[model samples]
Target chain A: MIIIAILIGCIVGALIGINAPVIPYTYSTFLAIAVVAALDSVFGGITSVLKKNFDLTIFISGFFCNSILSIALTYLGQKLNLDIYLAALVVFVGRMFTNLTIIRRYYIEKWTSKIEKDDKELQQ
Target chain B: MKIKIKKEKLVMSITIGIACFALMLVMFMQFNMVKQTDITGIETMRESELRLELSSWNEKYNELNTIYQETVGKSEEYKNERESYEKTYELLSKELEQLNKALGKTDVEGEGIVIQLTDKAGTQLSEDVKVKRITEEDLLIIVNQLFAAGAEAISINGHRVISTTSIFSIGEEFLKVNGERIVEPYVINAIGNPDYLKSTVSGKGGHVDALKELGHETSVDINKNIKIEKYEKELHTKYID
Candidate 1:
């Protein structure tokens, strides 16, 4: 489910990037997607607060990271004058790498360590 | 007792699932908002720039048009001055021609008169004429025919209608005056001998009558002392030299 969610986010970001060149319509569509993404993030933050594990820095960092990445990607694409498809590809690559790194470090590696420590303590 | 334990596990799993989903949703929503703000900011800046560009273009166009109309407005005067210059040249040439003729030279003076037609009253032309309107092509044909009949000086409605003159109806009421706006009762005036000019202008199947047929009345007046005035310098346009 987490993988699917990440895939969906990346896909949404890519689609938004691809359609960014279409003048007037681009403005509305860009706003709509960003709003939806922000709402989803807010929902996550609320649940964390409810669970009493709320770290504003962590939540804020994630927010800034994705927003900055998306904007930087767009700006870099324009600065380099890349074609639309090429720009979309760049955004996709950037998003995928960042998401995978976060997931691996936070979920997989940490969980495996905790589980291994628990098994040793139980045997002792 | 076994059933109660299973129910407790089920409740815990459901709660965890809901909490996680809600947490994810919040995170995504916050990120999305920031991204949108950035994109909109960039777009707004770009749009403002485009508007400024468009406005500048319009200003330049208006400046040129003002210059053009001012120049064209004084066309009659320019034409008169040009004719005077040409006349002096012609007289000198004629003297030379006479000398050359005496010396068995084949040079001869090319004599001709320029005629112009104008409406005495500044009344709007009749419906038929308004419907047809005046066209550059029509003016060209008239000028060409006059030149063919040996016309020397040519002007129309106080404006030295040139090769570039485009006569087309503008909007619902006005005519395009040098791509600017102008109203009707266009007067066509010429400088030439009456007898020869009348005969030459109105002779055979002519366009003068065609203009009349369209309903905007046309009167070909012959002026023996048709002293066309000198054109004052244009106020808007400038010259590099």
Candidate 2:
């Protein structure tokens, strides 16, 4: 039932998003940075869930805050004539990689333990 | 307890799903905008390929312009040649007219005056008195006066006076004009404006009055149409340029 709800929500949200009008070229850079931040947040959420410590409120707040902070930084960078977005990108991508590694390790360990238990049962 | 957990899970999954959907949508839109903004797709082209295309197009334009200039030059040359041909044709026709006039091959006609000079009537002259008649000298004077008055052509008794003409006395009653014998009364025809020719001859104390005073009967008449025959003598040039 949970999986069905998630699937329905994802499909509906995707449909709405696909039909939405594109933003102006000037704001696209901010959107790109926000997207990167959102992706990092998603990976972080997945990693936390795999570790059995996921908090819905924290995940939601992180997703929105990270995107908003990155966009604000990009605008400030334009005012200052600095490439602050590059710094933000680097940090977000690095965290995403770390989260991805954690997720990968959790899945590998779970799969290996399941296989080991099956072998022990067969030996008995 | 199981139902409560299941409800909580469902809510969390829905939220996560919505976030994921939003992320995907933003990614698609950004991708589309970037593709549209980069129209030339220059990022995909190598530097050498761009330079080669630019140089080839420039060469093509230069070749086309060269061909255009060559055609323009050829047309200009043809125009100059045609103009030169027209000028030469005009010059040749003008020379042909001058040659015809010099050769006296053209029969000419124009508005002019005719003068008749004869001896005084025999009834008015006694046998003892010397009778004055028109002579070669008198004829020469009249011809010179007519030429000074802008006569274009002159003839006396059907004989055309060209540059080679000779006037002399043939006998006491006959005169030679252009080697042709002419008798009195001598008829002189001159082609020119009749008004100016008449004024030149009949003016006060002019040549006509002078001839009348010399006991020669003279009459002047203005004729609108006067024809002069072409010189019939064969011309022989001893020397020419």
Candidate 3:
């Protein structure tokens, strides 16, 4: 699942890059990505607060990673003189790669095994 | 174990499907508006093209109109020039004939009278006391009085006075008559009704009195039976059109 997400991100980025100048909703695409990233970060924070196991390091790292990604994307736009849409899509691919490789491996494996078992039973 | 779809899932699915359908409807309306805009843009381009053509025609028409007016103005100017030239030619021809008669040898007899005016030497000067010399203005006044009295031909100090001539001072010690320089004690000779010219000069309130007031003497001599010589007038300046 993680690998599939990275592949999907790459495909989305390439497509957006190819249609760079023509995409009218490029701004909205970045907005949507930002909204989802913020929501995920907030939910994770809330869960940690409720459990009372909020290691300052873990809490800070999780938020910092996403914040760094957002800041890095903006920095890339300024440095490369890129359109905001192209920059956001490039950063999205980078985040997807990071997620599938290390961040979401445990969660994706756990969910994939369960999905496979369910599929086998349905087939049977 | 078999899983069944619940009521909440069914309601959520219906909500998502309705939202997607509404989004599609908006996209369709947007595409239709874009098409309408394209059509209107074509119409506007056609209208602009027509306006440009009309403006070109207007510019061309105005250019032609100006040309026509300038041509008419030039024609009127040429006509006035031609008419004036003809009138000047007639006047000059008459002057030439008179000059030829005056200069040409003539067995054919015609009558002319002469009047001579001489100033007394060293008279009682006027209040100005400026040597009491005769002036060009005085000669012009006497010549004009002779012509007014119907004198046909006139001369002053060997220079003939024509229809157009001016007698004036050029510098301190020199005066010009018909543009020729001369000195003082001017002798004026004119041919016409000598008796009439003599009366006109000696008449009451005449140039004779005016000259006397300016401290210069004047006289009129009539030569009726004298064998007069005719001479041609040589014009040195073009004074008239």
lDDT of 2 by residue, A1-124 (tens): 6467557766775676666776777788788998999989989988987888989999989998999999999999989878799999999999999998988888899899999999999999
Error of 2 at A13 (Å): 5.2
Q: What is the C-alpha RMSD of each candidate to the true structure, in Å?
A: 27.8, 9.0, 20.6
- Cα displacement (angstroms), candidate 2, residue B115, comes to 12
Number of the top-ranking candidate, with TM-score as the measure: 2
Point out where model 3 deviates above 4 Å.
Answer: A1-124, B1-99, B102-131, B225-241
True contacts kept of each: 0.00, 0.52, 0.00
lDDT (0-100) at residue A23 of candidate 1?
A: 34
**Candidate 3, fnat value?**
0.00
Model 2 off-target regions past 4 Å?
A1-27, B1-14, B37-241
Question: How high is the lDDT of residue B27 in model 1?
Answer: 39
lDDT of candidate 1 at residue B34, scale 0 to 100: 45
lDDT tens per residue, model 3, A55-78: 444544554465456646755664
The total of clashing pairs for model 3 equals 4
Per-residue lDDT of candidate 1, residues A38-91 (tens digit) = 443444555565556766556555544544454455556556755333444455
lDDT of each: 0.52, 0.82, 0.57
Candidate 3, pairs of clashing residues: B102-B230, B102-B231, B103-B231, B103-B232
What clash pairs does model 2 have? Answer: none
